[model samples]
Target: MAIIKLSAIERRRLSAFATCLVLSVFAWLFTALSSQQKYKVKLLAVFKNSPQKRAFHSLQPDSIYATVQGTGWKMLFSRMNGDDNKISIDLSALENKNYVVLSTQLKQINAKRDIERQVVSIDPDTLYFDLSNRLIKRVPVRLVTALNYQQQFAQSDAINIKPSYVTISGPADVLAKITYWQTDSLILNNLNESFNARVNLHPPAEGNLTVLPKSVTVKIPVDEFTEKTMQIPVKLIHNRNFYDVKIFPQKVKVTFTTSLKDYPDINEDDFEAVADLDQWLQGYRVLTVRLTHMPSYSKIVKIEPMNVDFIVKK
Candidate 1:
């Protein structure tokens, strides 16, 4: 511990280490400076030609802004590489003007160095965004039958659909070709009473038609109908009691058409006829009976002779 001192060679080595450390720091600083630089660029957006009206009137100044971060070299390289960092503004947000300024700011490598001023100019600040609204109609759906379904079963029921209408929006050229929107074919067989289902609306293939509400609901009503043949016994009614009377027709044939739900409750008793023999006997050789009573829900399609003939026996 008495005395320990660095030799000449050790001093030289220590000085060299210090110098290298300083030079490394300087090199790092230069590299950083080269990576960070600020510059201005112009942005443009073009709209397709159309007769439709536009939403935005014009863009204002101070709308253009710069994205700050990289060195001038990197920014220039990015520009040459076709790297676009511009923000797109919606045309519908603008009024009658054609262009508007989006934003403007100084871009820099670091937040501290970002204070450098950069001038940015955007030509045609306002962009014309053409837009239009078109009305699309709904087409009636066709009824189809399943392959396995009984062919004899006819469509004797009514059909109902929910949300009968739908709206569509898109490019004017595309929208104009649309005539109507139709749903897929729906098959109903042996259906009774009420039915609820979901269906999709199909757009025409040729147009640029786009439906606002893509889907819709469909409803159909099913009912039962029946045809019944009934035999109504014929009876002769005479005005004078105990007068000898005779009926040529022993029974009357009656056919009724009604709903299946109520057909079972219907019978021949539902119909009747009264004959006035006194008035009919004077000039007529036979008196016929006409229908006087029938079920409200039932319809009489035909009756044999349309009446019952009766003769007076003296």
Candidate 2:
């Protein structure tokens, strides 16, 4: 290949020409973008002001198109940035009419946007709905939680939710199928103290259903646990034949953990330890001690004598 080297003066002239060419292109672009232009943009449709007598479901997509007039720069950036401007549609008309003209709402929709970019027209001009009989019902709210407690710590009482029920309004067929609404998961880990906060409910999965008061207050009681030991008398069962049975150990030490607040309330009377005499018929020499009843909140630590030798005389 042949190389043609330019002199320093020639190189300087070429650099100046390149700079001017770049500046001209930028100036032209600025002029073009400053002029007013019209373009299309996607606006999300938000339905509100639903009629009391009717429940309706939209048959069209949740988004609609708008022809907007604005400066070229705004139009270009609006498309590039994918702005999510929303237009709220009133549903009161559904009480007497089945269709809504979007053009009739152009003034309100434009009011939500910048004055420089006004909506000129709406595509498809009208919206239609599937009508149904509306029903309103009050339903219980179910709390959902995923909680992990620190060692020696546990929930001390029943969880409480303010406003245990919520009112739901929707199509009669839909509301008839819903007995209870569930809150979003309340997740906590390594919890050592009581919890109190407001949590959101799961949104209605169906577009036509609506839940009032989207959130609720939740309170959970927690406390540190301590071990308690008691001497529980063992009772024999299945001795219907009136046979006399004597076990070597008449009592067993029951150790369990209960919340500090509940420790004083729990007693040996709340627990029952039993040995089934029927086991002897199966040729077992020792009777296994089993706890037939215990407090629901207590966690058993150990039973000192899990088995005892017994003598059965008919």
Candidate 2 local lDDT, residue 71: 94
Residue 274, candidate 1: how far off, in angstroms?
A: 21
Where model 1 places Cα greater than 4 Å from the true spot, the runs are: 1-156, 169-180, 188-194, 223-225, 229-257, 262-314
Candidate number achieving the greatest lDDT relative to the actual structure: 2
- Model 2, runs deviating above 4 Å: 1-4, 76-83, 239-242, 277-279
lDDT of 2 by residue, 207-295 (tens): 67889889999999999989899999999999989898899799999999889888888888899999998899989989999999998
Candidate 1 lDDT over residue span 168-228, tens digit each: 5555555456556677665565555555777766643422244546556665533455678
What's the lDDT for all of these models? 0.54, 0.89
How badly does each model clash, as a count of residue pairs?
A: 34, 0
Q: Model 2's lDDT to the true fold?
A: 0.89
**How much does candidate 1 score in TM-score?**
0.31
